[model samples]
Target chain A: MAIAKICGTETEYGLRMLPPGDHNPVSISSLLVSSYVDEVQRQIDWDFEDESPGNDARGFSLESAMAPAVEAHLLNAVLANGSRYYVDHAHPELSTPECTDALELVRYDKAGEAILRRSMDAARRVLHEGASIVVYKNNSDGKGNSYGCHENYLMARSVPFAQIVHHVVPHFVSRQIFTGAGKIGSEARWWDRAEQAPHFQISQRADFFEEIVGLETTLKRPIVNTRDEPHADPQRYRRLHVIVGDANLSEVSTYLKVASTAIVLAMIEDGFFGEMDLTVENPVQAMHDVSADLELAKSFRLVSGRTVTALGIQWELLQLAKKYAAERGLDCVGGEERGSDALARWERTLELLEQDPSSLSRQLDWVAKLELLEAYRDRTGASWQDRRLAMLDLQYHDLRPERSLFARLDMERLTSDEDVDRAVREPPRGTRAWFRGTCLSRWPTQIVSANWDSLVFDVGSDPLRRVPMMDPLKGTADQVGALVAQAATPAELLRLLSE
Target chain B: MMPERELKKRSSASRQDEGDVAASAGAPPEAATAARQGERIKADLDDLLDEIDEVLEDNAEEFIRGYVQKGGE
Candidate 1:
């Protein structure tokens, strides 16, 4: 059987202070995060001692790929909602709490957006007159630089890194058919040819990735990232940090992005993909080409000399996942039911794409964005390179609910408004997040620092007691809710834990 | 301490599926049985809430009030 697919997302929102001139993003992002933390009154610090971003899974460490420094000066706060709301690399980042299933993850991701929206409001009060900060849930800045909306999945440590790379590379290259968040035009050097003009691409992050496999995220990003930080029992599991995905506004796209990837990971762990190597020759180039090809007909040669389109590859993966589920059951992708939902949606999306890509204009992010832009261009007689169109593209991702084009779209929502509202305040009950969130909610001031796998409590003692949550599946509501309710203060909780 | 609120509305979305997995691919019989066992394990291992609002009522009033308050005229 496959391991439980525990997962979460870390979204680094693009930020710019209004009257966008020579301004520092670091200061603006810090202001945004600080204002939110101040407004919520949950200003607990983040523990960064367990992070090991430089330890690559490819056996040898890249000495140049130094881990991110823990800047204690930055406004890094752990929310009572079991999330980390902070400034990461000069961008306002919201790392959702660990979730047991994809649907729960979607609710938390939406809550992150709500947090950003509130942060925008809080930041406005502190800003200078006629100057407000704006945040976008998109990947690129329309310049050469790109931010990330990274995904993390827990995989078993027994699986070889090489097999993970080989199996996942093809899916990463081709899954953009539905997972893409859509971009205005290409910025990669390879697309600078005279014959191939810069036009709308399917994915916003594809053009920026330069390497097939690497450790550096800001510079040369890899398709299958080799970062081996599990944040759990290291001997039992490995956390797959995927940096290649775009921040999707459409809920259906977000669901598919996490669910389908989880199913594939399960198949990989179960040894179900027997000799089915759909490895592309040059994944970096193919990733760009597949994104640029809107028609979904552009074919890339696989390692077996067989040419396959992105849609074709998705269809193959879907069929395999279906068979895997039929035999193994959809248990690893949450349960039989949720796994079935993923397959049904995956099949329907592929079926619609096969008929006409426009058929999915309401469900898929790229198609809807393309339709919106093209309709505007036709109505106003504007060229593809019109600056107004680019502005429209940027407005699609604006964090302000009323101004955001994505918010206005008739996209299928997997989560309810009430649930999303609750997720903004409460944590999921099935993981260690329950303990972390309940603690923060019960005794906010007593907690000094918290991270993915540990929490430090100040009990009016000289040395704070650190509770280790090394098991992602442990410390759930069933295990810790009674204990948390029974203990009142940090001292009592520590005593109870010791008992 | 506040009483645990009963969820009047279904907080967790109904994970209803349209169709079953099409077992067209040629997998051995053992694989199918292994998958069934996996399904049993999945159910036993994780205890998720059918009603998310039960545990989620702690800060609802504060959150909604804050949201409306922040939407200043």
Candidate 2:
């Protein structure tokens, strides 16, 4: 039996206050996250030291022994649990420890819920707390935007990186159907030929701009990850860092989202699914395509020259899942109605693929994608030119307000040099602190500050922190290929300054 | 060929095992005395078992004869 380990944490939602007399419900919810963080932190000082032997005073402890005083201090606070409330970038994020099983994962995810409820209660206790909070479970706003929904998987480094991505991407794309937090509206369809909607059945972003960088807000991208670090153990393991998923309100959906992926990954490692043949024609487009689809019928050709549609792969995996369920004596899949619906959808998608692969193929085109976007908008009765939509479009795309038309037209064309220079010289709107912030920002600041040369963060460190920035204009055909060349670990790269 | 007396003894021992199980199951509760008085079921069961065993022993020669006939057929 393959052991499954799923460890994930979500930030306490950030709040953005609406102007006086604005009746938008979402804005009210946003205000709650903003005001709640300060009140919660005032009640508990997460930076308090624990006095345990051989333990750093500032470091966190699994058990509250080192700082008995701090433990006693926490009881006086609103949150009875010793969970810390800290500033994650600009957002208040409550992180739960890595859990070993699905039930434990549920417990950790629920911890966020408890934190939110308590914060709301605390707010009610205080006078002049007028703001409401809306928690978003999305990665980006619709219209090619991006946000963070980070995933951290402890993987054995012995597995090759290429193999991990190959087996994982298709499932990552398809999993959104079950796990997608529903979205409200869409953008104007760019193409006039097709009647497809611009808005999606599942929108990654409900709100446009998020000041924070964490998973608790929204599901914008199918996966937002930085493939920078790899563990050095000879019996290698890679902690897969994933940041793209909606903050799930439904416990069952959250369980299925995390557990099913863990199982699929286990199957991949176990060679139960055989091998994923989809060599994504364009990795970035494939990612965006997966995010846009609602029915999960999108098909990509396998490396074997055969096409295994997402529906096909899911059906085969479900068969194996049935055996797993039986062996584990789990009734998780017991609901006949849901099982029937899943089966029906699975069959319907298979039929669609067999009847018309062109329907899916057309979706691959930029024009068709725009049509889908428009179709969704029409269905939702949303205007494409709405300012909220525009801001959402920019935010979801992670496009800077000042980005040139050329950069907007081709993100792959933007090189490390241009990105670095822009980040250093002009920096995007509200991003001046990316250079100084202790918390990680949405953009890779460590690489950007290094410029194209070997970046060095500190001079005295034994290993110098360096990153190779690829010249986007002159680099290879791969979009990220032109960015930065891989350098020594941050520690090694930092040591070069002293030399 | 004459069967060993030990086989007969083993059969009798298995019968005693069944009797032990039935005895250890305990008598009906006082609440069911009315139903138990009318049933007299254990006596009937014991009589049926004796009849069954007698029937088997009496038909043993004929049973062997039928087996040989079936083989011939």
Q: Report the Cα lDDT for residue A200, model 1.
A: 92
Per-residue CA lDDT of model 1 for A1-499, tens digit only, reads 9888999999988876765566777788899999888888779888888887778897776776554574566789888889998877678889999998888899999999999999999989888888888888988766567889999998999999888888888899999989999987776777557359447989988987888887778877778788888899999999999988999998888899999899888889889999788989888889988898998889999989999999999889998999999899876678988889889999998988887887677688899788777766765687877765676677678787545667645467898999999999998998899999989998898899999999999989778899999999888999978988999798998888889
Docking class of 1: incorrect
Backbone N/Cα/C clashes per model: 1, 68
Per residue, candidate 2 scores C-alpha lDDT tens digits across A167-279 of 66656655554455544344323334444543544434323322212222232222333232321121343456555455554444455566666655555555555533545
Error of 1 at B55 (Å): 39
Measured with C-alpha atoms, the lDDT of residue A231 in candidate 1 is 91
Can you give the DockQ of every candidate in the order shown? 0.02, 0.00
Off by over 4 Å in 2: A1-4, A12-14, A18-84, A124-146, A185-197, A203-237, A271-283, A295-298, A320-499, B1-73
Give the CA lDDT, 0 to 100, for residue A157 in model 1: 94
